[model samples]
Target: MTETLVRIDGVTKRFLENGTPAVEALTAQIKSGQVTGLVGPDGAGKTTLLRLIAGLLLIDDGTLRVCGFDPKTHAAPLHRVVAYMPQRFGLYEDMSVIENLELYADLRSVIGTERDEAFARLLSFTGLESFTGRLAGALSGGMKQKLGLACALIKRPRLLLLDEPSVGVDPLSRRELWRLVYELVDQDIGVVWSTAYLDEAERCASVLLLSEGKALYQGPPQALTRSLEGRTFQVRNISGERRAVLARALERPAVIDGVIQGRSVRLVVGKGGVAPAPGDIGAGPEAVIAAVPPRFEDAFMDLLGGGPRGRSPFADAYASREHPIDSVVEAQDLTRRFGTFTAADGIHFRVKRGEIFGLIGPNGAGKSTIFKMLCGLLRPTSGTARVVGLDLAKAPSEARARLGYMAQKFSLYGDLSVRQNLEFFAGVYGLGGRRRRDALKRMVETFALGPHLDVDASTLPLGFKQRLALACAVMHDPDVLFLDEPTSGVDPRTRREFWSHINAMVANGVTVMVTTHFLDEAEYCDRTALVYRGRIIATGAPDDLKERARGAGRSDPTLEDAFIALVEADDRESLA
Candidate 1:
């Protein structure tokens, strides 16, 4: 029989006097030897619920018990049996990996032989045995996450709480993280994983879906996904541009959600809403409409009132400007070296006018290095990068003036209000007077950010932060836009909203070069380049790469399958 690790009844927590509760009347049970996913959108109280379980926060009302102890009255004992890893794990960057592990062991009082055994086991399990001497500051994004997990497990607690552990991790690393957590579950450790990725939630033993601090559903992910069956479909053989078709489909009252998948548009029709025909969605006479398997994302969007609809106001406001050159972004033998290490080795790619080119790879695979060199943030070691026919090395400022960049992390001033950040970026991009005011007004209206104009950028939710970042990035309306993981930790609906604007911009002849870990998002790109260990291993359309990985037992493969297969094959060749 499985042990019930946590029990909650009518729990409520609020941070403000009159504001909505962060968590309201939540009731659930978490069992040992199982993974319970706390899934929700930004500010959905997922984090608050996790914190309550770990005894980090007190519930205002309701009965709560963890490991048979009242958290509010017995937090100390609860802490001994529980381990909480926050979104930002407190790893000391200046310390070596081994030193950091030892520090955590000391904090947990696991000294001598026990500490030594735990360190050895963790290092081996996380694949960090070879890099134990490296500094934490120099570790890759995925490696840092593993190290944090190792530290969290130093005490070997019975319950584990993870807050978005795989936020910016690559697919391969994310799979490994899941493996590590399940290994602990096999030992009767209860795990609660909070995440924005619906696919991940689908793998959990059970999921607690939250919205506006209230529980919308609590059960197996399949239960929710099953409800969306017969309503999900694939619209194929599009006569017009796929993006245009998707935009048109989203406008229909019957369509709850729609997105570009390969060459077709995947849609979810509202319950009791009429199913759309090919002609209804602007498809050609020969276009085919087929009912497809429902996914967890479809159900999530359905419960959340669907994603943003209608054409992007930002795209509508963008006036098309012609560039004399055909290729807007060109990188020829781009190379960048740091001391004894080469970060980018002879990389070459080109983005034609009005194209969306994607650069994707594992963590620390030099995608960001190539992006920085092209954007003039870093100088190339031996080759040339140009934007709008201007050499970045010789005419960096001139080249940059025609570019818009959004970093992997939010780069706006946290202390500044939403309005202030917009004003600052506008000035930096040379907008003034009526033009600046008009741009701000348009951005506020486009992203629906009018309500939070005076709020600090740092205080905004994850989705709003992403919107603000994008609004500032495109306020200048540059000819070329560079986005580095623009939708890294946002929810599916937020991603749809972001891509809607991006697709609109591309249709209007604006060129875009983006790097992302979300392979699904790569489907929107005209072409993609796969970088690995400072080199381009493959470059082609998403379907092309998927075809390359298809063989033997697998006739059809997902983008993630192709990514893993390609990387594994390369690893084997390197070993040989």
Candidate 2:
């Protein structure tokens, strides 16, 4: 029999007296040598529950035990046996990699030979052995995550709590992180991973799903995913644009959720709802409504009352603007360098009017460098970039006026109210008087931001913050929109909603250039360019890329498979 590391019985926690409980009446057991995922959307009490288990937060009611000890009464002792790595793990930026490790060791009372052995083992395990002298600030996103994980393991706790450990990292690094965690689990350590990514939850031995502070399900993810088996399908041979077909399919009462999957639209019919016929989705007589395998994400959205439906109000309110040029964004031999280090090598790509182009790669692979060059936020050392026929280097301001950019992190004013942020962005974008008022009003209505108007931006939920950011980015109605990891840590339902708005805008002749870590999201792009070591290793449609990476024993390939295969192949060639 496996040992139970944590036992919660009717546990509840609340930050505000009158406000709803952050976690309410939650009961679950976590066992050693296994991963138990805490799956939920934003503000679903995942973090609160993890904190309660770590003894960082006291339960308001019921009993909670960690390692057979009451956490409420034995907080300090419990802390020694449990390690909690929050979403933003604290790593001293100014310190070297070794210095950060040493500091963490000092804090955990891991000294002398024990500290040295731990450091060596962790550095090797995390693949940070050669970067010991490097500054923590200079590490890539994935490297920082590895460093954080290493720091958390310095004391070798019995139970490990990780909150969104794979949020901003690339697929390659995410795989590595999973490997590291499972290795620890093999050593009899219990791990409770809190994540917005349902796919990760699917890999867990068991999952405790929460929604609005209530336990919705507690079982193997396969149990939930199995429930959606026959109801899921792929609509192929589309006669019209795939996005438009998807939008129409989602609006149907019978369809619970739909998303653009490569050349086809994947739909999930409501339980017992009849699947659509060929003609229903504007497809040809040869169209196929093939039943497909169900995933944890499909089940997750269904449990959340199905993803956002119908047409996007933002797209409906958007006024179409004509551009004389077919290519809205162009990068020719775009290169950027920091001293002797070449961040972005000579690269070339073009985004046609109304096209969704994705730039994807591993961390530090020059995607961000190229994005900055195109956005006029950073100047290219050589070559040129253009937006709407204006040269970015010579006419950055004019080019910027025709483009909208949403940064990786939320860029709105946290201290200001939602309405204030909207108005402020409107004014910054040069909308004045009636134009400003109309823009703000449309944003509020389209994004359903009326109720959040008086709420400070910082207090809004993750999904709301994403909506507000997108609203602010498009308030000016620019011809081209740039999104950098727009849905990094967002839940599947919220991501579907966000993409619905994006697809709508794209249908209305707005061009989009995006960079994302989620490989599944790359399916939405009409074309994708894979950047490896500052060079474009591959560029094509999602299916084309997958086909390129296909080989024996792997007949069906996902975008992530293509990503890893292509990147690793490039690495081998370079080494040879």
- Which 10-residue window in model 2 sums to the lowest lDDT? 313-322
Model 1: per-residue Cα lDDT over 272-313, one tens digit each: 986688887778897898999999989999999988877888
Clashing pairs in 1: none
Evaluate all candidate structures by whole-model CA lDDT and list the values in order.
0.91, 0.90
Q: Please give, for residues 1-576, the per-residue lDDT of candidate 2 as tens digits.
A: 579999999998989988899988888899999999999888899988988888888899989999988986888888889988888748999999999999989988998899889998999999999999999999988999999999999988999999999998999999999999999999999999999988799899999999999998999999999999899999987776888788777778999998888888899999889888878777667788999999998998889888887788866777777788888999999999999999999999888999999999999999988998999999999999999999998998999999999998888899999989998888789999898888888889888899999999998988899999999999899899999999999988889889988988988899999999998888999999999889999999999999987995679989999999999999999999
- Cα error, residue 116 of model 2, in Å, equals 1.3
Locate the minimum summed-lDDT window of 10 residues in model 1.
307-316
Q: What is the lDDT of residue 417 in candidate 2?
A: 96
Model 1: what TM-score?
0.98
User: Model 2, which residues run further than 4 Å from truth?
Assistant: none
